[model samples]
Target: MSKRVLDVGNCGPDFSSIKAFLTKNFDCTLDQAHGMEDSLAALREGNFDLVLINRKLDRDYSDGIEILREIKADAVLKDIPVMLITNHAEHQDAAMELGAKRGFGKLEFGNPETLEKLQPILG
Candidate 1:
Protein backbone atom coordinates (compact mmCIF):
# COMPACT_ATOMS: atom_id res chain seq x y z
CA MET A 1 0.00 0.00 0.00
CA SER A 2 1.22 3.46 -0.82
CA LYS A 3 1.47 5.83 2.10
CA ARG A 4 0.23 9.41 1.91
CA VAL A 5 2.20 12.34 3.32
CA LEU A 6 1.30 15.94 3.90
CA ASP A 7 4.22 18.35 3.55
CA VAL A 8 3.51 21.66 5.17
CA GLY A 9 5.15 25.08 4.74
CA ASN A 10 7.86 24.01 2.33
CA CYS A 11 8.77 26.29 -0.57
CA GLY A 12 8.52 25.10 -4.16
CA PRO A 13 12.02 23.76 -4.56
CA ASP A 14 12.02 22.16 -1.16
CA PHE A 15 8.71 20.47 -1.77
CA SER A 16 9.90 19.21 -5.13
CA SER A 17 13.05 17.78 -3.63
CA ILE A 18 11.16 16.13 -0.83
CA LYS A 19 8.58 14.70 -3.20
CA ALA A 20 11.27 13.30 -5.42
CA PHE A 21 13.19 11.73 -2.57
CA LEU A 22 10.11 10.12 -1.10
CA THR A 23 8.84 8.83 -4.43
CA LYS A 24 12.20 7.36 -5.32
CA ASN A 25 12.67 5.64 -1.99
CA PHE A 26 9.20 4.58 -0.92
CA ASP A 27 5.77 3.64 -2.11
CA CYS A 28 4.16 6.92 -1.18
CA THR A 29 2.60 10.14 -2.44
CA LEU A 30 3.23 13.63 -1.07
CA ASP A 31 0.91 16.63 -0.92
CA GLN A 32 1.78 20.21 -0.10
CA ALA A 33 0.34 22.97 2.10
CA HIS A 34 1.85 26.43 2.51
CA GLY A 35 0.78 27.39 5.99
CA MET A 36 -1.04 26.45 9.16
CA GLU A 37 -4.61 26.85 7.97
CA ASP A 38 -3.92 25.01 4.77
CA SER A 39 -2.12 22.25 6.61
CA LEU A 40 -4.87 21.79 9.16
CA ALA A 41 -7.49 21.71 6.46
CA ALA A 42 -5.61 19.10 4.49
CA LEU A 43 -5.07 17.01 7.59
CA ARG A 44 -8.73 17.13 8.42
CA GLU A 45 -9.77 16.11 4.94
CA GLY A 46 -7.13 13.63 4.01
CA ASN A 47 -5.74 10.37 5.28
CA PHE A 48 -2.08 11.15 5.66
CA ASP A 49 0.30 8.62 7.16
CA LEU A 50 2.75 11.30 8.17
CA VAL A 51 3.18 15.07 8.19
CA LEU A 52 6.37 17.06 7.49
CA ILE A 53 6.22 20.62 8.74
CA ASN A 54 8.85 23.19 7.88
CA ARG A 55 10.36 25.07 10.84
CA LYS A 56 9.45 28.40 9.30
CA LEU A 57 6.82 28.71 6.63
CA ASP A 58 8.22 30.08 3.41
CA ARG A 59 4.88 31.62 2.60
CA ASP A 60 4.61 33.93 5.59
CA TYR A 61 7.62 33.20 7.78
CA SER A 62 5.24 31.95 10.45
CA ASP A 63 6.41 29.49 13.04
CA GLY A 64 5.76 25.91 12.03
CA ILE A 65 5.73 24.89 15.68
CA GLU A 66 2.33 26.49 15.96
CA ILE A 67 1.05 24.19 13.24
CA LEU A 68 2.61 21.22 15.00
CA ARG A 69 0.96 22.30 18.21
CA GLU A 70 -2.39 22.55 16.53
CA ILE A 71 -2.15 19.06 15.15
CA LYS A 72 -0.97 17.62 18.46
CA ALA A 73 -3.77 19.31 20.34
CA ASP A 74 -6.63 18.15 18.18
CA ALA A 75 -8.24 14.89 19.23
CA VAL A 76 -8.58 13.46 15.75
CA LEU A 77 -5.40 14.86 14.26
CA LYS A 78 -3.14 14.37 17.27
CA ASP A 79 -2.50 10.71 16.52
CA ILE A 80 -1.14 11.40 13.05
CA PRO A 81 2.65 11.39 13.15
CA VAL A 82 4.27 14.80 12.60
CA MET A 83 7.88 15.78 11.96
CA LEU A 84 9.41 19.24 11.94
CA ILE A 85 11.88 19.81 9.11
CA THR A 86 14.77 21.85 10.46
CA ASN A 87 18.51 21.69 11.00
CA HIS A 88 18.45 23.16 14.48
CA ALA A 89 18.59 20.64 17.30
CA GLU A 90 16.83 23.05 19.62
CA HIS A 91 13.87 23.28 17.25
CA GLN A 92 13.82 19.54 16.75
CA ASP A 93 13.82 19.07 20.50
CA ALA A 94 11.00 21.54 20.85
CA ALA A 95 8.90 19.69 18.30
CA MET A 96 9.67 16.37 19.94
CA GLU A 97 8.67 17.82 23.28
CA LEU A 98 5.31 18.54 21.72
CA GLY A 99 4.86 14.93 20.48
CA ALA A 100 6.44 15.23 17.01
CA LYS A 101 8.73 12.56 15.67
CA ARG A 102 12.37 13.47 15.07
CA GLY A 103 12.43 15.13 11.65
CA PHE A 104 15.33 15.70 9.29
CA GLY A 105 16.52 18.98 7.87
CA LYS A 106 16.44 19.83 4.16
CA LEU A 107 20.20 19.49 4.16
CA GLU A 108 19.85 15.92 5.36
CA PHE A 109 17.13 14.95 2.92
CA GLY A 110 19.22 12.36 1.08
CA ASN A 111 21.19 11.07 4.03
CA PRO A 112 20.98 7.42 5.00
CA GLU A 113 19.95 8.39 8.50
CA THR A 114 16.96 10.15 7.05
CA LEU A 115 16.01 7.00 5.20
CA GLU A 116 16.41 5.04 8.40
CA LYS A 117 14.15 7.41 10.28
CA LEU A 118 11.49 7.31 7.57
CA GLN A 119 11.54 3.59 6.86
CA PRO A 120 9.18 2.52 9.59
CA ILE A 121 6.67 5.11 8.54
CA LEU A 122 7.02 5.13 4.76
CA GLY A 123 8.49 1.75 3.96
Candidate 2:
Protein backbone atom coordinates (compact mmCIF):
# COMPACT_ATOMS: atom_id res chain seq x y z
CA MET A 1 0.00 0.00 0.00
CA SER A 2 1.12 3.54 -0.68
CA LYS A 3 1.80 5.93 2.18
CA ARG A 4 -0.10 9.21 2.49
CA VAL A 5 1.43 12.68 2.86
CA LEU A 6 -0.39 15.80 4.02
CA ASP A 7 1.27 18.82 2.49
CA VAL A 8 0.13 21.85 4.50
CA GLY A 9 0.84 25.25 2.99
CA ASN A 10 1.10 26.55 -0.54
CA CYS A 11 -0.08 23.98 -3.06
CA GLY A 12 1.14 26.07 -5.95
CA PRO A 13 4.28 25.49 -8.00
CA ASP A 14 6.50 24.72 -5.02
CA PHE A 15 4.29 21.96 -3.68
CA SER A 16 3.64 20.74 -7.18
CA SER A 17 7.30 20.00 -7.66
CA ILE A 18 7.58 18.20 -4.32
CA LYS A 19 4.42 16.25 -5.03
CA ALA A 20 5.54 15.26 -8.48
CA PHE A 21 8.95 14.18 -7.27
CA LEU A 22 7.63 12.21 -4.33
CA THR A 23 4.86 10.49 -6.26
CA LYS A 24 7.20 9.55 -9.06
CA ASN A 25 10.00 8.27 -6.84
CA PHE A 26 8.13 6.95 -3.83
CA ASP A 27 4.98 4.91 -3.38
CA CYS A 28 2.92 7.62 -1.78
CA THR A 29 -0.14 9.82 -2.21
CA LEU A 30 0.21 13.53 -1.51
CA ASP A 31 -2.70 15.76 -0.53
CA GLN A 32 -2.60 19.52 0.12
CA ALA A 33 -3.96 22.00 2.68
CA HIS A 34 -3.80 25.67 1.94
CA GLY A 35 -3.83 26.93 5.50
CA MET A 36 -4.33 26.06 9.14
CA GLU A 37 -8.06 25.42 8.94
CA ASP A 38 -7.70 23.27 5.86
CA SER A 39 -4.83 21.42 7.47
CA LEU A 40 -6.83 20.74 10.64
CA ALA A 41 -9.77 19.56 8.58
CA ALA A 42 -7.60 17.20 6.57
CA LEU A 43 -6.04 15.82 9.72
CA ARG A 44 -9.46 15.19 11.21
CA GLU A 45 -10.58 13.38 8.09
CA GLY A 46 -7.91 10.71 7.70
CA ASN A 47 -4.56 9.24 8.49
CA PHE A 48 -1.35 10.63 7.05
CA ASP A 49 2.04 8.96 7.24
CA LEU A 50 3.84 12.24 6.95
CA VAL A 51 3.19 15.98 7.04
CA LEU A 52 5.17 18.50 5.00
CA ILE A 53 4.74 21.96 6.54
CA ASN A 54 6.00 24.92 4.58
CA ARG A 55 7.39 27.94 6.41
CA LYS A 56 5.00 30.27 4.71
CA LEU A 57 1.29 29.87 4.24
CA ASP A 58 -0.75 32.54 2.46
CA ARG A 59 0.60 35.07 4.93
CA ASP A 60 3.90 34.41 6.65
CA TYR A 61 6.27 31.79 8.05
CA SER A 62 4.80 31.88 11.56
CA ASP A 63 1.59 30.22 10.45
CA GLY A 64 3.39 27.03 9.63
CA ILE A 65 5.03 27.00 13.03
CA GLU A 66 1.69 27.52 14.69
CA ILE A 67 0.19 24.58 12.82
CA LEU A 68 3.22 22.48 13.67
CA ARG A 69 2.72 23.18 17.35
CA GLU A 70 -0.92 22.25 17.10
CA ILE A 71 -0.10 18.94 15.50
CA LYS A 72 2.52 18.17 18.11
CA ALA A 73 0.16 19.05 20.93
CA ASP A 74 -2.58 16.81 19.66
CA ALA A 75 -2.52 13.33 21.12
CA VAL A 76 -3.87 11.67 17.99
CA LEU A 77 -1.63 13.46 15.51
CA LYS A 78 1.52 13.93 17.54
CA ASP A 79 2.97 10.65 16.40
CA ILE A 80 2.92 11.54 12.73
CA PRO A 81 6.22 12.51 11.19
CA VAL A 82 6.28 16.24 10.45
CA MET A 83 8.90 17.99 8.34
CA LEU A 84 9.19 21.76 8.15
CA ILE A 85 10.32 23.28 4.86
CA THR A 86 11.80 26.74 4.74
CA ASN A 87 14.26 28.88 2.83
CA HIS A 88 16.39 29.43 5.90
CA ALA A 89 18.29 26.72 7.75
CA GLU A 90 17.80 28.61 11.01
CA HIS A 91 14.30 27.17 11.29
CA GLN A 92 15.62 23.66 11.68
CA ASP A 93 16.39 23.86 15.39
CA ALA A 94 13.03 25.42 16.22
CA ALA A 95 11.15 22.88 14.16
CA MET A 96 12.95 20.00 15.82
CA GLU A 97 12.17 21.42 19.24
CA LEU A 98 8.52 21.45 18.26
CA GLY A 99 8.70 17.72 17.44
CA ALA A 100 9.32 17.92 13.74
CA LYS A 101 11.20 15.04 12.13
CA ARG A 102 13.41 17.51 10.29
CA GLY A 103 13.51 20.92 8.63
CA PHE A 104 14.67 21.23 5.04
CA GLY A 105 15.19 24.21 2.79
CA LYS A 106 12.76 24.79 -0.07
CA LEU A 107 15.66 24.39 -2.52
CA GLU A 108 16.26 20.85 -1.30
CA PHE A 109 13.02 19.47 -2.62
CA GLY A 110 13.18 17.16 -5.65
CA ASN A 111 16.86 16.54 -5.08
CA PRO A 112 18.73 13.33 -4.26
CA GLU A 113 19.96 14.61 -0.89
CA THR A 114 16.46 15.30 0.34
CA LEU A 115 15.31 11.97 -1.06
CA GLU A 116 18.00 10.16 0.88
CA LYS A 117 17.14 12.00 4.07
CA LEU A 118 13.51 11.01 3.68
CA GLN A 119 14.20 7.28 3.43
CA PRO A 120 14.01 6.42 7.12
CA ILE A 121 10.87 8.41 7.66
CA LEU A 122 9.21 7.01 4.59
CA GLY A 123 10.19 3.50 5.60
Candidate 3:
Protein backbone atom coordinates (compact mmCIF):
# COMPACT_ATOMS: atom_id res chain seq x y z
CA MET A 1 0.00 0.00 0.00
CA SER A 2 1.08 3.57 -0.55
CA LYS A 3 1.93 5.80 2.36
CA ARG A 4 2.09 9.52 3.10
CA VAL A 5 4.89 11.22 5.01
CA LEU A 6 5.02 14.74 6.35
CA ASP A 7 8.60 16.03 6.54
CA VAL A 8 8.94 19.14 8.67
CA GLY A 9 12.06 21.30 8.49
CA ASN A 10 14.28 23.32 6.23
CA CYS A 11 15.34 21.77 2.98
CA GLY A 12 18.80 20.31 3.51
CA PRO A 13 21.03 17.35 2.87
CA ASP A 14 19.30 15.39 5.57
CA PHE A 15 15.96 15.99 3.95
CA SER A 16 17.44 14.96 0.65
CA SER A 17 18.73 11.74 2.13
CA ILE A 18 15.36 10.91 3.58
CA LYS A 19 13.52 11.75 0.39
CA ALA A 20 15.86 9.63 -1.65
CA PHE A 21 15.57 6.71 0.69
CA LEU A 22 11.81 6.81 0.81
CA THR A 23 11.51 7.22 -2.92
CA LYS A 24 13.73 4.25 -3.59
CA ASN A 25 12.17 1.93 -1.05
CA PHE A 26 8.55 2.82 -0.50
CA ASP A 27 5.52 3.70 -2.53
CA CYS A 28 4.91 6.95 -0.70
CA THR A 29 4.21 10.63 -1.08
CA LEU A 30 6.00 13.42 0.80
CA ASP A 31 4.59 16.69 2.09
CA GLN A 32 7.30 19.12 3.09
CA ALA A 33 6.83 21.59 5.94
CA HIS A 34 9.30 24.42 6.38
CA GLY A 35 8.24 25.41 9.87
CA MET A 36 5.99 24.53 12.78
CA GLU A 37 2.95 26.32 11.41
CA ASP A 38 3.21 24.58 8.11
CA SER A 39 3.72 21.26 9.81
CA LEU A 40 0.64 21.67 11.93
CA ALA A 41 -1.41 22.69 8.92
CA ALA A 42 -0.31 19.65 7.03
CA LEU A 43 -1.16 17.37 9.92
CA ARG A 44 -4.65 18.80 10.14
CA GLU A 45 -5.27 18.64 6.42
CA GLY A 46 -3.97 15.20 5.64
CA ASN A 47 -3.59 11.72 7.04
CA PHE A 48 0.01 10.67 7.12
CA ASP A 49 1.57 7.34 7.90
CA LEU A 50 4.64 9.04 9.37
CA VAL A 51 5.94 12.43 10.41
CA LEU A 52 9.64 13.39 10.38
CA ILE A 53 10.33 16.57 12.28
CA ASN A 54 13.78 18.11 12.43
CA ARG A 55 15.36 18.76 15.79
CA LYS A 56 15.47 22.32 14.63
CA LEU A 57 13.44 24.07 11.98
CA ASP A 58 13.87 27.22 9.86
CA ARG A 59 13.51 29.50 12.89
CA ASP A 60 14.88 27.45 15.80
CA TYR A 61 15.78 23.95 16.86
CA SER A 62 13.60 23.92 19.92
CA ASP A 63 10.55 24.66 17.85
CA GLY A 64 10.53 21.11 16.59
CA ILE A 65 10.13 19.77 20.10
CA GLU A 66 7.19 22.07 20.65
CA ILE A 67 5.73 20.77 17.43
CA LEU A 68 6.29 17.22 18.64
CA ARG A 69 4.44 17.93 21.86
CA GLU A 70 1.54 19.38 19.97
CA ILE A 71 1.32 16.38 17.72
CA LYS A 72 1.31 13.97 20.64
CA ALA A 73 -1.34 15.93 22.45
CA ASP A 74 -3.73 16.19 19.56
CA ALA A 75 -6.42 13.49 19.56
CA VAL A 76 -6.34 13.02 15.81
CA LEU A 77 -2.64 13.55 15.18
CA LYS A 78 -1.40 11.51 18.11
CA ASP A 79 -1.91 8.30 16.20
CA ILE A 80 0.63 9.09 13.50
CA PRO A 81 4.15 7.81 14.10
CA VAL A 82 6.44 10.78 14.68
CA MET A 83 10.22 10.72 14.45
CA LEU A 84 12.51 13.55 15.50
CA ILE A 85 15.56 14.01 13.29
CA THR A 86 18.74 15.24 14.86
CA ASN A 87 22.37 14.27 15.20
CA HIS A 88 22.39 14.95 18.94
CA ALA A 89 21.66 12.11 21.32
CA GLU A 90 20.55 14.54 24.02
CA HIS A 91 17.96 16.05 21.73
CA GLN A 92 16.77 12.59 20.79
CA ASP A 93 16.05 11.76 24.42
CA ALA A 94 14.01 14.93 24.79
CA ALA A 95 11.93 14.06 21.78
CA MET A 96 11.36 10.54 23.04
CA GLU A 97 10.27 11.90 26.41
CA LEU A 98 7.71 14.01 24.59
CA GLY A 99 6.17 10.86 23.06
CA ALA A 100 7.89 10.71 19.69
CA LYS A 101 7.75 7.28 18.15
CA ARG A 102 11.51 7.38 17.64
CA GLY A 103 14.51 9.70 17.37
CA PHE A 104 16.25 9.67 14.03
CA GLY A 105 19.83 10.89 13.77
CA LYS A 106 20.34 12.87 10.59
CA LEU A 107 23.83 11.47 10.27
CA GLU A 108 22.36 8.00 10.00
CA PHE A 109 20.19 8.95 7.03
CA GLY A 110 22.44 7.30 4.49
CA ASN A 111 23.30 4.37 6.68
CA PRO A 112 21.60 1.03 7.04
CA GLU A 113 20.54 2.00 10.55
CA THR A 114 18.11 4.53 9.08
CA LEU A 115 16.36 1.82 7.17
CA GLU A 116 16.26 -0.47 10.18
CA LYS A 117 14.90 2.22 12.44
CA LEU A 118 12.28 3.11 9.83
CA GLN A 119 11.12 -0.43 9.23
CA PRO A 120 8.39 -0.46 11.83
CA ILE A 121 6.94 2.85 10.69
CA LEU A 122 7.24 1.93 7.05
CA GLY A 123 5.64 -1.43 7.58
Candidate 4:
Protein backbone atom coordinates (compact mmCIF):
# COMPACT_ATOMS: atom_id res chain seq x y z
CA MET A 1 0.00 0.00 0.00
CA SER A 2 1.11 3.54 -0.68
CA LYS A 3 2.00 5.71 2.28
CA ARG A 4 0.58 9.21 2.53
CA VAL A 5 2.72 12.26 3.33
CA LEU A 6 1.72 15.80 4.23
CA ASP A 7 4.17 18.42 2.96
CA VAL A 8 3.75 21.74 4.71
CA GLY A 9 4.98 25.24 3.89
CA ASN A 10 6.78 24.60 0.63
CA CYS A 11 6.37 26.79 -2.44
CA GLY A 12 5.44 25.50 -5.90
CA PRO A 13 8.84 24.43 -7.11
CA ASP A 14 9.88 22.98 -3.81
CA PHE A 15 6.70 21.02 -3.47
CA SER A 16 7.04 19.74 -6.99
CA SER A 17 10.58 18.61 -6.33
CA ILE A 18 9.54 16.80 -3.17
CA LYS A 19 6.63 15.13 -4.90
CA ALA A 20 8.79 13.94 -7.75
CA PHE A 21 11.50 12.61 -5.47
CA LEU A 22 9.11 10.78 -3.20
CA THR A 23 7.09 9.28 -6.03
CA LYS A 24 10.20 8.06 -7.67
CA ASN A 25 11.56 6.30 -4.59
CA PHE A 26 8.52 5.13 -2.72
CA ASP A 27 4.96 4.01 -3.11
CA CYS A 28 3.43 7.17 -1.71
CA THR A 29 1.16 10.12 -2.35
CA LEU A 30 2.09 13.68 -1.35
CA ASP A 31 -0.27 16.48 -0.32
CA GLN A 32 0.75 20.05 0.48
CA ALA A 33 -0.27 22.90 2.79
CA HIS A 34 1.20 26.39 2.74
CA GLY A 35 0.80 27.29 6.40
CA MET A 36 -0.22 26.34 9.89
CA GLU A 37 -3.99 26.37 9.61
CA ASP A 38 -4.21 24.22 6.54
CA SER A 39 -1.57 21.86 7.84
CA LEU A 40 -3.45 21.24 11.07
CA ALA A 41 -6.74 20.80 9.26
CA ALA A 42 -5.24 18.35 6.81
CA LEU A 43 -3.67 16.34 9.63
CA ARG A 44 -6.97 16.14 11.41
CA GLU A 45 -8.83 15.08 8.29
CA GLY A 46 -6.40 12.68 6.70
CA ASN A 47 -4.33 9.68 7.60
CA PHE A 48 -0.65 10.29 6.98
CA ASP A 49 2.49 8.28 7.47
CA LEU A 50 4.82 11.23 7.57
CA VAL A 51 4.85 15.01 7.48
CA LEU A 52 7.59 17.22 5.98
CA ILE A 53 7.55 20.80 7.24
CA ASN A 54 9.63 23.54 5.73
CA ARG A 55 11.75 25.60 8.12
CA LYS A 56 10.33 28.82 6.77
CA LEU A 57 6.92 28.97 5.25
CA ASP A 58 6.84 30.19 1.67
CA ARG A 59 3.50 31.97 1.92
CA ASP A 60 4.30 34.38 4.76
CA TYR A 61 7.83 33.45 5.70
CA SER A 62 6.56 32.53 9.13
CA ASP A 63 8.39 30.08 11.32
CA GLY A 64 7.50 26.46 10.74
CA ILE A 65 8.59 25.50 14.23
CA GLU A 66 5.28 26.80 15.49
CA ILE A 67 3.50 24.29 13.31
CA LEU A 68 5.77 21.54 14.62
CA ARG A 69 5.03 22.56 18.19
CA GLU A 70 1.32 22.52 17.52
CA ILE A 71 1.45 19.04 16.11
CA LYS A 72 3.54 17.73 18.99
CA ALA A 73 1.24 19.39 21.48
CA ASP A 74 -1.93 18.01 19.98
CA ALA A 75 -2.94 14.67 21.39
CA VAL A 76 -4.46 13.45 18.17
CA LEU A 77 -1.58 14.49 15.94
CA LYS A 78 1.42 13.95 18.18
CA ASP A 79 2.15 10.44 17.12
CA ILE A 80 2.55 11.06 13.43
CA PRO A 81 6.18 11.26 12.34
CA VAL A 82 7.33 14.70 11.21
CA MET A 83 10.50 15.94 9.53
CA LEU A 84 11.59 19.53 9.04
CA ILE A 85 13.10 20.40 5.69
CA THR A 86 16.13 22.57 6.34
CA ASN A 87 19.87 22.77 5.76
CA HIS A 88 20.87 24.03 9.18
CA ALA A 89 21.94 21.69 11.92
CA GLU A 90 20.56 23.87 14.70
CA HIS A 91 17.11 23.81 13.18
CA GLN A 92 17.26 20.09 12.57
CA ASP A 93 18.33 19.55 16.17
CA ALA A 94 15.48 21.73 17.39
CA ALA A 95 12.93 19.76 15.41
CA MET A 96 14.26 16.46 16.69
CA GLU A 97 14.13 17.75 20.23
CA LEU A 98 10.46 18.42 19.62
CA GLY A 99 9.96 14.81 18.49
CA ALA A 100 10.52 15.01 14.73
CA LYS A 101 12.65 12.55 12.86
CA ARG A 102 15.90 13.64 11.20
CA GLY A 103 15.03 15.61 8.07
CA PHE A 104 16.91 16.36 4.89
CA GLY A 105 17.82 19.67 3.37
CA LYS A 106 16.52 20.86 0.03
CA LEU A 107 20.12 21.22 -1.08
CA GLU A 108 20.52 17.52 -0.42
CA PHE A 109 17.16 16.38 -1.66
CA GLY A 110 18.42 13.83 -4.13
CA ASN A 111 21.35 12.62 -2.12
CA PRO A 112 21.60 8.93 -1.24
CA GLU A 113 21.84 9.72 2.44
CA THR A 114 18.55 11.58 2.31
CA LEU A 115 16.83 8.52 0.94
CA GLU A 116 18.46 6.38 3.61
CA LYS A 117 17.29 8.76 6.29
CA LEU A 118 13.74 8.38 5.05
CA GLN A 119 13.83 4.63 4.83
CA PRO A 120 12.59 3.70 8.29
CA ILE A 121 9.55 5.89 7.92
CA LEU A 122 8.73 5.48 4.24
CA GLY A 123 10.40 2.25 3.31
- For candidate 4, lDDT tens digit of each residue in 1-123? 899999999999999999999999999999999999999999999999999999999999999999999999999999999999999999999999999999989999769999998889889
In candidate 1, the residue pairs with backbone N, CA or C atoms under 3 Å apart (3 or more residues apart, or in different chains) clash, namely: none
Per-residue CA lDDT of model 3 for 22-108, tens digit only, reads 878778878798887788899999889999988778556556888899899999889888988888888888888888866667567
What TM-score number comes out for model 3? Answer: 0.88
Candidate 3 weakest lDDT stretch, 10 residues = 55-64
- The superposed Cα distance between candidate 4 and the true structure at residue 63, in angstroms, equals 0.5
User: Local distance difference test, per candidate?
Assistant: 0.95, 0.83, 0.81, 0.95
1-123 per-residue lDDT for model 2 (tens digits) = 789999888658878888887887789999998788889889989989999998878545446888999999998889998988886767877889898977577777756878887887674
Q: Report how far off residue 104 is in candidate 1 (Å).
A: 0.4
Better of 2 and 3 by TM-score: 2
- Model 1: residue 47 alpha-carbon error in angstroms: 0.4
Candidate structures ordered by lDDT, highest first: 4, 1, 2, 3
**CA error at residue 109 for candidate 2, angstroms:** 2.7
Location of the lowest summed lDDT over 10 successive residues in candidate 4: 102-111
Model 1 agreement with the true structure over 20-88: per-residue lDDT tens digits: 999999999999999888899999999999999999999999999999999999999999999999999
**Which candidate achieves the best lDDT against the true structure?**
4
Higher-lDDT candidate of 1 and 2:
1
RMSD of each: 0.6, 1.7, 1.7, 0.6
